[model samples]
Target chain A: MTTAQHLAEQWPGERPEAARRLLLAAVDSFSSRGFHATTTRDIATAAGMSPAALYIHYPSKAALLAEISRHGHATTLALVEQAVAGEGDPRARMRELVEQFTAWHARGHTVGRIVNYELRALPEADFAEVAELRRRIEEAVKQLIEEGVAADLFSVAETRTAARAVTSLGIDVARWYNERSSESPEQLGSRYGDLVLRMLGAQVD
Target chain B: MTTAQHLAEQWPGERPEAARRLLLAAVDSFSSRGFHATTTRDIATAAGMSPAALYIHYPSKAALLAEISRHGHATTLALVEQAVAGEGDPRARMRELVEQFTAWHARGHTVGRIVNYELRALPEADFAEVAELRRRIEEAVKQLIEEGVAADLFSVAETRTAARAVTSLGIDVARWYNERSSESPEQLGSRYGDLVLRMLGAQVD
Candidate 1:
């Protein structure tokens, strides 16, 4: 097997750095050139290896994209889940969710782009898999909104739409967010959290 | 000039139906295969036209892309400008913007996709030209939010970010929106408008 082929082998270990290298390259190429536009060769070259080496690590370009998309969505879901699973009123939990979400996207916008922008490019089965997880995330947000409505924290004719709007605000961070901009990611997150809290009529401070 | 050249010459205007036919083919090919992965032949074949015929209306693939992108943005701006220009309360105007935006994307989804998803393909000069109009629309939203804040009709820190969120939600409508599954575009627009207004804290009947 080629050197590229050798690297394609997944060792049974944490190997965080190697995984990070692979994911980072995948995200850059995926966002810049798109899924179909990018090639395994391009990704491997960018990762400082031959395409064969990439295959040893990744079976195909679709697989690489799926891995990245899966990780990114799972990460966002984890953060969001953690944010809302905490103690305090539903409003407080919602604030935490917003803060975590905005901060994550602000700092790592590319991850969001990879997760959301490339959703359409995923192969049908893979797309369905990712969609299931995305639906989970959406449900989390939906539940949060429903809880807020139940608590009289948020008044809306349709909790589903409210959930979608709030979720869209958060999901969109990946598209227009910039970490190097004037506002720090934390500051931006807090600001957005404030807005979300107010919108929901949650007690601030 | 070849038929491709002819397509370029009459493109985007003279033959309205043909323009849309070619544009739809272009959107699918561009989004799926991307500009480089796709060729004039790919689009021509998709449009069921000779490559030369495709060129007759579009000078080059890049030109074809630019035209589609231009039409999408311009149409959006026109719709918003029209929707908001009428005499209505700021809250009403916000609803109008959301309704018009969602409807436009739902109806002109392919155009929206090509406009948004293909930004990177645009040459630097072309990119800036298209992006400027998008920026202006964004700025207009910011201004609206700021006005709401000033008038105590709405409350949100960082009008700019709220505007970003709002625009982000609307722009991404085409990315995942599907008409076949369920939910009419008007319903989505109306529902989206309702949520946006509530988020903005507009206490309207």
Candidate 2:
């Protein structure tokens, strides 16, 4: 799929067409101009609607951000959860997890940037909801590392720290990856998967 | 020194007192509220000056951000250069480089966040200047990995990818780190140092 196709897929199909357009426009504005910099009028104008029409779908600019943040976090959380549920030993699961996680961030980097970097811009209640999703995401990775250490497939001194490092490897890809980037998301993900496996001290294939 | 003291040291000592105050205030506001959201009036008030006074120090908000970006990039570039110049083989140098680099990010995360995440907010000319500094920083790490590979101290399939992974590990620290974090900069840096060594396939001490 094209980059634009991938970004459009991030929002749910169940939402109304107007709401979806507003969300997509918000993602573009928030990612490029940042959450604090982007105005509600800009988002409405980009969505080809009047400011009054935007309020019908989302009450405030912060509400629009909160919805976008919710969608992005939920999508990534499901991605990690699926990776964890896949068939494999700890080493295999980890490779799959890192590769898919890295590729997801790289492919949908616009949403990734907003989800990862703009959390602080979220309102207090909205931030708490997203934080819960993040905690679950981290726990899934940590559990995989714990399983690896138990099976003697990987040697790790601190599983929590190792999990953080592994996730950081993928999350930061969004910050740097772009059209000018040399590697495709798949190629970058593959390389990062191997590097993360090595970091975990697993046997490289 | 306290975190506040460490943050203050990021600005050069040679700058005049009022300019330094304006710069520090800008860092605090920009980092917290973000560059797009913060007003010159807010920065001036935070610095205990009128908005007119801020213009005397920085002609515009973008100019203030550019100055902060310049100082931050120069500081980190010098950091990597110093580590690369230190004693021992590539393994030892890589350890020192990751340790110090990671610690710097964790300790000065406020400035680190602005420097790393807010680059897109910079004007065209300023962005190009900071990009050059970033290129040099990446080259410094890549050279150390190349040295390690040549010396048979480290094993790597792709030198460039590995260097990016190593730097990403440290740079992401600024995103998650805060007072609530469990590890001190030193402790976190030591762990990351070992992880990078492992990722490089270097002999871990």
Candidate 3:
């Protein structure tokens, strides 16, 4: 399956049917309209439920957003972790890491955009948890760069800043990605991987 | 003066004080709260005016946002244009381009964040105009990269993609910048210039 299709399927969370509908509605609403602008009624309507039906699933819009944020971050963190799991040359590992990260952002841009851009809208408590997931994502990338440096495959002046830029190249993909755009998620992922490898002064194929 | 301070001073549009106050309020509201979530009432209250008073300045909240976007784009375009002007070496030109672009995003992040991220929020007509300005910005960068390649000073395989990535490195800076952050705008601009130069395979001094 295409990466975008995979992402589409992943959005069908493991909640009950009613709750899933509400969550899906929240995703659509929050992705297009800012979280603050979307009301419980709008979400309920989108999900084909009554206004109060939303209450049974989510207490408030913020709660709904929190659920979405947590789920998105957790899933993404899992993807990043999985991307880095296989053993290889550190350079190859970094390539896989950038490819997968970029693919996720391109394919799952709605949730990715919100997860990366809308942290302020999440309640403070949820923000902390989501931020932790983000930190781990950064650390995963950082560790790869550090490993590459130790292996002498990469010549980077500052591993931390280089890692951030590498990830930023992927994260910012969500900000511009659209299906109508020319590049496929896989193509974008591969291209960005090469560009980041270039930035690190790695031997680029 | 600091770039942020300079950006802060750039918000006073060619409007009357009341209108400028309304625009400033919109910038704060849109920056903190996503544009859709911020109501006319919120803007007016933030500006210390009644809800009805906003109509005297802007016909609608979207109009106010459009105004801010147009002004912001114009100023940034001017900056980008000037950065690429009077350049000696193509390498030096690219370095200056990245530096000034990064500084703009860092200092003008309050509005830059919105302008870069909230294109979907703009009306269709206004979006077209803003998009054209964006195209010009991208074209300018691409032209510079092309010039460097033609001169054999830079070795980028994909000039368009490389230019986009270079700009993205700076644009994404706005999403995470805070006054409390350790790196000042000038410092960040300098660092990013080096990084882009590195990505271009330019010899770093």
Candidate 4:
């Protein structure tokens, strides 16, 4: 699928078509212009709706941002959790996790930018909610690394720091990845997977 | 020094005091609220100047952002170049480079965020200028890695991708580092230095 289609599919499928449209528009505006700079009117206009209609679906611009932030965080967390749950040795799992996680960030970079960089603009409660999801995401990666250490599959001085560094490689992709990038998301993710495995001291093919 | 003081000194020392204060204030406001949301008035109020006073120093909000972006990028480039030019083998230089670069991001995260994450808000010409500096920064890192590979001190399938991943580790520190973080900037940098060495397949001490 195209980048636009990938971003459009990020919102929950259960939401009404209009709500999804507004959410997609908010992602575009929030990622491009940032949450603090984007107005509800801009979102409404981008979605081809009136401001009153936007208000009916989402109470305010902050509300739109809150929903987008929650969905993005929750979706990524689910993907990571699934990667962790998959059947593999720690080395194999780490490779899959990094590859898919990095690819997700590259493919959905617009929403990734909003969810990762725009958290400060979120309301206090919304910020806390997203932070909890982030913590879980970090925990999932840490668990994978710890398992690797226990099984003698990896070596690291600090597992927590190692996991954070691993996630950092993928999360920052959102900041820099674009159409002009040299590699496809899959190719980038695959290369990162190799580097991450080496960082973990796992044998690389 | 305190984080605030560290951020304050990021502006060039040769500029007038008033301009420095305004630039510091702009960094605070722009980093927290983002470039598009922050106004000349907000920056002026933060700097204890009137909007007219701010305009006297900076013609517009975008100009303030441009100056801040240019200064931040140039300072980082100079530091990285200095590390590259210093005495040591490629392995030693890479270790020192990652340690210092990571700490710089952690210490001056506010300005780091503006330079790394807020580039989209810059005007066309200003963005191009900053992009040129970023290209050079990447080249410096790539050159170091190339040297390591030439000396058989490091093994990597792609030098450019490795360089990007190495910088990614440091640049993303700005996104997540805070007072609440367990590691000091120095400690974080040191740990990352180790992880990066392993990632580069260099012998760890």
Candidate 5:
């Protein structure tokens, strides 16, 4: 599927369809124009609504960004959480987590790009919450690496740095992922899973 | 030892002191507010110049971005080139490349973040030039990995993916390197160098 199609399926939070359209429109504007440069009118017009109609869903453009940021963060956090929540060997768990995380960034790259890179655009007050959520996401990955090391499944020296490297592999996917590339998200994720395991000195099968 | 000091030392790129000040201002503004959100006025005012004074150095804000983008890209490419030029071995070359690349991103992170993330804001024609430069950078890493594989020094399965992961580790440093985090750029680069060799399945010494 295309990035736009995949983004519509992944994000949008719990808002109604109409509000979801506005959020998606805001994402498109923010993705292309940068959040500060994107006006409410641009979002509204993109959503096929009157400028005032946006206020019915979000009080301000910042609110719109906050919603998208919060929802995207929550969704990604839950994905990592779920990836590690299952019962399995830590090696299997690490591979699964990398696969899921990498695919999320690739499939939902539009929202992924904005949510990953546009952190500064959120209001400072809103940024605190979003940052806390990201902190949790990073922690989740760190825990996985720590587990792998504890079980003797991985031989990583620095758990924190290895965790950051694993997370970075996925996050950077949004920066340079081209759907037209021959590699599918699943293939990329699998390769990344292998690479992460190798980085930790875990045997890759 | 600060990111600012390192940036000044690393990337002035033959411009006059006055023009260098403007480019630095552009980097700061683009780093925080992003390319589209920042006005030429903001850039000029940040540089302690009148609005029109910016035009004397660069024709347009886009021109300023192109100059900054091109210089930043070329600087990074040159650093990577120099790292691999006089290397002892392919594995050593790879480690040195990652070390320098990671340090460059960490130390010059303000400009690094813009050069790494703000490519989308460049005009299509300008982006093409930047993209070609980036392609060459990636190819350099790819060549190093291929060399390691050919010499039986590394056991990477996919040279291209391994190369991309090595590059990603350094590029993402720009996004999350915090001076307050206790890991200096030198320390981070050292750790990253070790980790990268491990990822390439080379023995980490």
Candidate 6:
């Protein structure tokens, strides 16, 4: 009955195949020519369809942006949930999250650009979906920090700030990371996890 | 002299006052509408000048992008130099650098978008300028980490990774930072610095 409940119902069956193709086209066009420079025709051409046909899947360029943005949030949230739900100590949980995160970004590199830089192109309604998901992610990390605080495992005075810093640091890896770089995902993840733990004032053992 | 050196000598002037209005226009259009979406007409309209008249001031859109990017990098390198130069200790210097970085991004929020997100849009030559400055910045942080390592004030085994992590964290703050957030610029700066230092294994005093 609630708005959230209604939206939750819609998310599951949102034309997955059509949405995926449309999103892929949007990402390719936007990342190459950028959001402002890219036209509906570009996306349509990339999708091997007409602009009108594209509209059946996405209402507008903004809608296409929102679709990609939503996908970004959904993908990250699923991975984080899987990483955090398993049994492990707080430190171990953090390492698992980082490893999963690095791998996700490594595998879905274009999604990084969609999530981080292209938000401005989204219409207001579409932007809210990504923002809400990003907030959920922030809350998840903040909850972990709160748990650490409750147990006196970390020395952070402000769990909120620590959560932002930790999350931001990991999220940023998506921006600059290149598989061509010398560090493997596992190596990068371990090293990043070590530093993230230290950022929390936790022992990195 | 080499062609690169000749090109350097033939480089356009850096008169801050002369290009202030044009640069401001570029930043606004670039961030709001994006690089490719924006046109000389948009910029000229914003500056109340003819597009052709604007050309007399700068060579091309690519040239303007390069100059803005060049200025951004120069400002960053200079700030880090000043922040860490003749400093008390590595911890203090890192804090100073973080604080300065957060403030700079806050103040330059418009230009910040183009500086952080325009790498893919940059022509090969322009990218080199930005990349060179980015390298200098990483080296600056690396120097600080090495100093801390030499003093046994921080962990030594992963100084290179630590340096990358620290630089990446600060560079990334520009990407998602919203001034509307509850945290003030200084507060975010101090908190981010704390995390950066922790990641470096810096001893808190």
Cα interface RMSD of each candidate: 2.4, 0.7, 1.2, 0.7, 0.9, 1.2
Tens digit of per-residue lDDT, candidate 3, span B1-205: 4533454488645667788788888988888888987899999999899989999878899898888899888887788788778467888988888888888788887887888878888889999999999899888888888888888888887788788888788889888877776778888888788788878877544
Model 1 ranges with Cα > 4 A deviation: A1-13, A16-20, A201-205, B1-18, B203-205
Q: Model 1, range A1-205, lDDT digits (tens) per residue?
A: 2212222332224665555466567777877787777888888888777887777777888888888777677777888888778988888888889988887777667667777767767778888888888888889988887888887776666666566667777776766765456777788788777667655655444
Which has the better lDDT: candidate 3, or candidate 5? 5
DockQ of 3: 0.70
Better of 2 and 3 by DockQ: 2
**Best prediction by DockQ:** 4
lDDT of 5: 0.85
Model 1 chain A: lowest-lDDT 10 consecutive positions: A2-11
lDDT of 6 by residue, B1-205 (tens): 3322322332346554446667777877888888888887788778778988788888787777887789888888898889879568878887898788776665555566788778777889889878989898888988988988888787756877787777777777777666567876678788787777777777656
In candidate 4, list every pair of residues with a backbone clash: none
Error of 1 at A69 (Å): 1.0
The digit string of per-residue lDDT tens for model 5 on B43-92 reads 99999999888888888888888988898889889988887786488988
Report the C-alpha lDDT of model 1 over B19-106, residue by residue, as the tens digit.
6667768877887766657888898899999999887888778887987787678767777777667567778788888988986676
Q: Kindly give the number of clashing pairs for every candidate.
A: 26, 0, 0, 0, 0, 0
Q: Write the per-residue lDDT of candidate 4 for residues B84-202, one digit (tens) a residue.
A: 99898988999999999999999988788888887877889999999999999999999999999998899889999999999888999999998789999999999999899889999
Winner by TM-score between candidate 6 and candidate 5: 5
Give a tens-digit lDDT track for model 6, residues A1-205. 3322322333455566666566677777877788888889899989788998888877788887777678778878877777677677676787788777765565455567666888877788778878889888888888777776676677787888888777777777777776576776678877777777777877544
- Candidate 5 residues lying further than 4 Å off, grouped into runs, are A11-14, A203-205, B11-13
Candidate 5: CAPRI quality band: high
Per-residue lDDT value at A42 in model 6: 92
Off by over 4 Å in 3: A1-8, A203-205, B1-7, B12-14, B51-53, B203-205
TM-score for all models, in order of appearance:
0.87, 0.97, 0.93, 0.97, 0.96, 0.88
Clashing pairs in 5: none
Docking class of 4: high
